[model samples]
Target: MSMINNAHPGSSLVLLNLIDRVLLRKNKLVSRTELLEVLRPELLPKLSPKKKKDDEVDEVDDSDGTAMRRFEWNLDFWLKEGLWLQDDAGMISVSSGATQRNLPERVLELIIDNAKSQTDQEILDEKNTEPFFRAMTCLLVQQSYTFMGGETVLPGKNGSAQKAVNRWLPGERSLNLSNELPTFLQYGDFLGFLEPFGSGYIVDPTRAIEPYLKVVFASESKLSLNIFIERLAEKLPLLDGGRFRRLLEPMMEELGWSPREVHQVSPSLSHALVRLESAFRLRLDQASDDNSSMQLQLPEGKHRFVSEVVYLSEVNA
Candidate 1:
């Protein structure tokens, strides 16, 4: 829509057609809005044969609010799924789901294709990651991989009461039996409850490790190390390109930090920065595995942004 309004060579439907023709084969992102934002501005403007609109001057207002011109004229298309959450404090941006952009390419594709088949176990299971991801692209199983219970085949409907519970006293028996139990009725084991989310139950379906680089480390220790290392990396001419995060990768591997730090900070950080007692350990030989066959209790999400007193202007990365 933006491209078309800008004087693009085609209609909105034409832009969509271009997606299947060129974009899909490249393993590119599928969303039209996202693609427009990502596309080279020079080429995109060619699609629209219109002159650019002159910028509107800002209006004077004590309180911050959308100006009449910007809202009424500038907004080319309405955001259908846009949401603004207003609380006692102020308004904040909210999304439909899974806004994190740094997720791996395969994971991104699977999720974008409306397949959330990757399980919690798969997140931690490095060995099966390749095969599981390969299966996601297959026609028979992409969506099915996430749901083995045949959710895609048939429309969901209420089932017989007999399937609700495995056993019945006398009157509950019925002849209309498909044999397979209802999805809703099947109660997977409700074990220990994890941490509760702040934005209420709807958005936070389930809480787990944060992300790849950070999730692998205990919240406190990871932040602390990153903080200590980040400052050192910045101040000292230790690593070139300044992306020296992977430089410490060997040390992290040798120490078997994640497993050894399980549910708690490791000895290095725990001993120096965090004074908490060491909460995990392993036999001498078992520490070789990267997964460490162990893990620690992840701390709250916000704590992941640990900063240090560095010379550079206050930075957030």
Candidate 2:
């Protein structure tokens, strides 16, 4: 089953981090029973059923069966998804591909990367791409809305936005967008692609790309604006001109989304760069003689030009 179906957005990170910590502390593989024993206390409070005021009768189970069911669903999904590995003896440990360090941002990166690795065919067959598609759609919608000077609202379960996004899929597949949007938003927040705004989330991928800057730059301290964008797109294929973004472009165009002007960056990406520059993480420079400068479109219709980007290695920390 997909993460959207098996995992609750609020509880997924909590459970994942708990497992990572337990495994790290023990410095060895832990038995399934032992792992569950450790997780139950931390997980139950969040997953346990709550009494509704409208209920005519309240029958609470002493065994905490409902919580256990929710826990199992999440655990099973992680195990099958290769985030956590189980041995022949039922000994569990974090996946080797995951960063051993227990940083939240690192873990979120692992999740995002894993989701991105799934092929479209695999997603169509196994429905594992729901998380990726939902998160991408969320970011796209927010960015477009902001660019158009419209206030952002959470997509309604059966709203026109949801219907339009769902149309991105082929007739062979479909998503319950209303049902999956909350979890998608939660994941986006954790990944730093979206930030909490007035009433909902807004596109802000600066934090999201921070962890990958070194990976993208790879010892180079500076790059031409065009090269930096290329590397960033290679690292994160969901952004502007990325493989995933390209795949969605046809559908987006059908919905009246227009391409950015020549040498102009998309609003969301421009915002991210401007924020990074302001925070001293990077410096955007423009040469008087350089004709290849790119324009960063900022809020309130402001624009800044840059020909090169200097990634501050020390400041990224």
Model 2 is weakest, by summed lDDT over 10 consecutive residues, at 50-59
**Mind giving the per-residue lDDT tens digits that candidate 1 earns over 131-235?**
122211111111111112122222013322232222211122111222222111110101000111221111010111112223223243323333433443332
* Best model number under TM-score: 2
Taking the tens digit of each residue's C-alpha lDDT, what string does model 2 give over 169-261? 544344455345555556667667777776666667778777777777788988999989888877676676666666666556675666677
**TM-score of model 2 vs. true structure:** 0.80
Error of 2 at 60 (Å): 8.4
Q: What do the candidate models score in CA lDDT, each in turn? A: 0.23, 0.63
RMSD of each: 22.6, 4.4
The best candidate by lDDT is 2
Model 1 TM-score is: 0.15
